[model samples]
Target: MDSVSPWLVILGMAVVTVSTRLIGYWVLGRYQLSSRTQSILEAVPASVLTAIIAPMVLATGLAETLAAIATLLIAWRLPTVVAIVCGVVVVVLMRNVF
Candidate 1:
């Protein structure tokens, strides 16, 4: 048994990531996707977002949940900087007062 340096582990992961992406591009370029497949691919972003956020809302405390909602609301329509500042404010106030 041998211990590997952390840099080697990180380099290995980078290589794997790049290799897979290149392979995916090479393979996918050979095919033409139908409308149905394109539609499914378009839906993937929303589904992935839900998959990521569903558990965060379910598993966290009320303050965190409220913060997430606040963040989303401001982020949905406002500038990114405004949303971030307002979200931080909302979370801070919620945590302090709740």
Candidate 2:
């Protein structure tokens, strides 16, 4: 078998991601979703976030766990973007310190 180039893999992934997004948008636009379904869909971002963060919190070292806690606290009152930025900052600082 031929070895795949890294650029080819990256481009393939980007193409697939964009295609799926466009297809999802088109499919969803054609339907009138009920309020309950809409509410469920609105929660997808949080669900995705939990899936991404739960592992780091559970399996990673002290810095990541501490950062997750700090992010959670910041998220409770501040905007999500701010919380995310602060989380990144906290993790970097904690890693450097410890």
Among the numbered candidates, top lDDT falls to: 2
Model 1 Cα lDDT, one tens digit per residue, 48-85: 89899787665766776888888889889999899889
Q: Quote the lDDT for 39 in model 1.
A: 87
TM-score of each: 0.69, 0.65
- Which sections of candidate 2 miss by over 4 Å? 1-14, 77-89, 96-98
Candidate 2 weakest ten by summed lDDT: 52-61
Q: Cα-based RMSD of the predictions, in order?
A: 2.7, 3.4
* Candidate 1, superposed: residue stretches over 4 Å from native: 75-80
lDDT of 2 by residue, 27-87 (tens): 8888999999899999999999989878899788899999989999999999999999999
